[model samples]
Target: MTHPLRRGAAYAIGGAACFAAMSALVKTVGGDLPNSVVVFFRNAFALLVLLPWIAWSPGKRASFSTRRPGMHLLRATTGLAAMYCFFYALSQMQLASAVLLNYSQPLFLPFIAWAWLGERPPLRIYPAVLIGFVGVILILKPGMGWAGPAGIAGLAAGILAATSMAAIRRMSDTEPAVRIVLWFSVLGTLVSAVPAAMHWQTPSPTQWSALAGLGVIAAGGQLLLTRAYALAPAAHIGALIYTTVLFAALIGWLVWGERPDMLSGVGGLCVIAAALIVVVMRQRGSRTARA
Candidate 1:
């Protein structure tokens, strides 16, 4: 029999692959569609895909009820903003670079938690954060004249993602995962619609197909990641989440001929290392609190 940790790792990697594929699909259709439209469809189609799952699981249906509408709105709004920035970055920048920047969410998470939850992280996490920012600077290459507005947008995506995560943490005590996800999807679609309508362009047949797949894949990846965390300690499989960066890099290289320069490559490594450190430390802190 496979060890539970190994299985969890497998599931995490699988989720990473799904997300990478979803990103690639976004890049594919992004050429013709507005980012707003893409964001709207992502939420709309994800809701469509999510409904069946809830329907199939009888118990999960009741999870939709929530006492905290305000918190749900905060999470959904921030998450939607992150999606807008991330998708825009994907449309404009190298797939690998955009994905790497988005993954830097962990670098901002500590500060967000500190501000929102009044939880101070350990001193050791600071060095990792410093190293991660150094990596971010290298990737941005601002002084070298390589970084562009898209790079800023990509980094902004990370910050917004961290904020959304913090909001999720705030509500995790009383809110079920299903309810949180449902609220995000519902509010995301509704909020994205105003912009989507302003920028609507009928998608081509191929683009329509890709957009649909993007939603389904996004929801599937979320489910796989949830399962992975349920099966093992986050410290055991958190690093596996970075496989999305590797997979995105591979897809970029093959599909778009994107090759990050040496600086960007090194920076990506730094960011990944820093994120892993944060994940491990966060897990340790959780365990200590429980003990």
Candidate 2:
């Protein structure tokens, strides 16, 4: 790979690792706090950490300007819902399962683009999507009656997250990425505060440290993801996000003593394969279009 591609890959991997760590921390504090509280603190602290950059840099003003408040609202709402479902499902189910299911978003992205944006995906995208679904089935093992509500919620979270991502792509044409992220943090914090207040459990010092770490880790991850996308095409950087699953599995094993069963392992492999295929096809299609 070229230096730029390599750099992008490294940044993407770093982002994925940070995200995986955040997930593990959240899982560690799963029972001690409500999902709302967790989400609130995560976003709130992230926003706090980002405030220095946002305040000191005059360049960020254009990003906050509103030529598209409606789009921002839609994106933020979808993002909020996605996070809510994700945190809830993660709290209720195994970490590996929730992470695997949520990572299926890329497989659904092509169809969502075709339907919502009127842009047809390449033929290979369909088979890749089917393969990803098979992977999900493997993880869930529904025929053996192992699937549960947490799995269903995770799927819902994936769909919502996919939708939000699609909207983010569209919004990126008009709005800055930082603006979208800032709005998401702002809206997420506000929306989560209500429910968090209702189920408020004061965090111990250790839990507070974990929550703070969650915020810092998530903020760093988002920055790295943004940097990666800026340096390379989405197809190149996006597929690398699958590394989060492996990271999640490893962290879960080391920290929580949670291990995926044989089915989940097989399913995770399939999902990774499908994601790689999608990335390859997208790159080829882009090259062909340029040629």
Candidate 3:
């Protein structure tokens, strides 16, 4: 039998794979649909999927009595901003580059934890964080002068995502995970409505199919992620999350004929390695504490 930890790791990997598939679908649709429209439909469909669970479990509703409503709104706003910038960056840049930039979230996690949780990570995490940043710099290659405003937007998206995730961690103690996701879907959909309406292009039949598929895939990804977190610590699963980048790169190559260059390939590997090191260190620390 697989160990519980390994099973949780599998869930994390599966979630990343599902998310990667969703990203591929998003990229396939490309600039054909506006980012706002895409975000709205994605969350709207996800909300539909979660409705059954909401109805079946009354406890889920009760968990929303968050003491920090302002924090929830702030997190939601940042999350929406991250999604917008991410989709915009994907439209403008290479998929692998954008994925690499976004995966820097794990590196930011330590700093956010220190600031928000008042818990400093051990010194070992510093080298891993530095290595991860180095990978980002390699991917950005200052001398190349290839980056533009979109690249900066992508970085901002990463920061916002990391911040939102930290806020989620903080609130998780007081709220159930399902409620957090439900709020994200509802709030994100409502927030995107204005922009989606403003930039609405009547999706063709094929585009409509793609949008439906994107929503289903995104919902599945979120479900898997939720299950994974229930089974293991976030730090234990963090490294496995990088698998999404590999999945994105593969999908981009097969569907869009985009390939990662030497810099991106090296940098991507470095980032993944650093994330893995961090996860391993965290797991070791947990084991020691238990001992």
Candidate 4:
């Protein structure tokens, strides 16, 4: 059998890459369109993509037969809030800074789970989380040119995103992946409609294409992230999601000519190292648990 952690790692990594692409698209489109409008199309198109899957997958009929509507509702609402925050941050800051701040979810997962699910993590993760945040500081260099308020907004986005993720972890215990996604999609579309309508701007054909692509990428990432969290504890795979930053850095550099200085590079390494330490130690602990 494939080890659960490894499988979860694969899903998390896949989700990270998808998210990275989506972030790029957000930045690309956010220049011309409002963030709320982008969020609306993102959720709407994601549901449209999921429609066929929910219809065609084997045993898919049962995907919506969920008893945990409240959980799904909560997850969707929190997720929608996070989506707004993240896209807003993306619009207001450099792609790398926004992504780095948002990926700080790994630092908050353990505490959120402890408070919400009573899952106390290993003490070792504490230092690892601190190191990851330190990496974030290095990346932001707060006293430097990184915009003061926008950077803080990005940090808030990460916390809200982590809260939404923890809700996903709990729902995954009893919910099919499609069901969870369906609820979020439907709810996000509804929640974002008013705001999107208020700020609506007609996208050019090229921007429309980008928005559609964002939706598809968002769907894939959501499914993968939900599956990964279902297969293991949130903290176990949370670190793997940091790979999104590296991917974001590549996109930022090539497409936008943005480059992080030496200090930021060192900080990125620290963040990656912190996450790797957690993953490796978690793997070792998993072996011990299995024994």
List TM-score per model, in order.
Answer: 0.97, 0.93, 0.91, 0.84
Assess the local accuracy of residue 186 in candidate 1 as a C-alpha lDDT between 0 and 100: 83
Q: Candidate 1 lDDT, tens digit per residue, 80-160?
A: 998999998899889999999999999999899998899888999999999999999999998797669889989999999
Local lDDT at 87 for model 3 = 75
lDDT value for model 1: 0.91
Q: Considering only N, C-alpha and C atoms within 3 Å, which residue pairs clash in candidate 3?
A: none
Best by lDDT: 1
Candidate 1 off by > 4 Å: 58-61
The deviation in Å at residue 4 for candidate 4 is 11
TM-score-based ranking: 1, 2, 3, 4
Better of 2 and 4 by TM-score: 2
In candidate 2, clashing pairs total 0
RMSD to native for every prediction?
1.4, 1.9, 2.2, 3.4
Error of 3 at 164 (Å): 0.6
Tens-place lDDT digits, model 4, residues 28-93:
998789888999999888988878867765675336667788887888887788788788788777
lDDT of 4 at 269: 81
Window of ten residues with lowest summed lDDT in model 2: 54-63
TM-score: which is higher, 3 or 4? 3
Question: Distance from true position, residue 284, model 3, in Å?
Answer: 4.5
Ranking by lDDT: 1, 2, 4, 3
lDDT of 1 at 45: 92
Candidate 2 lDDT = 0.82
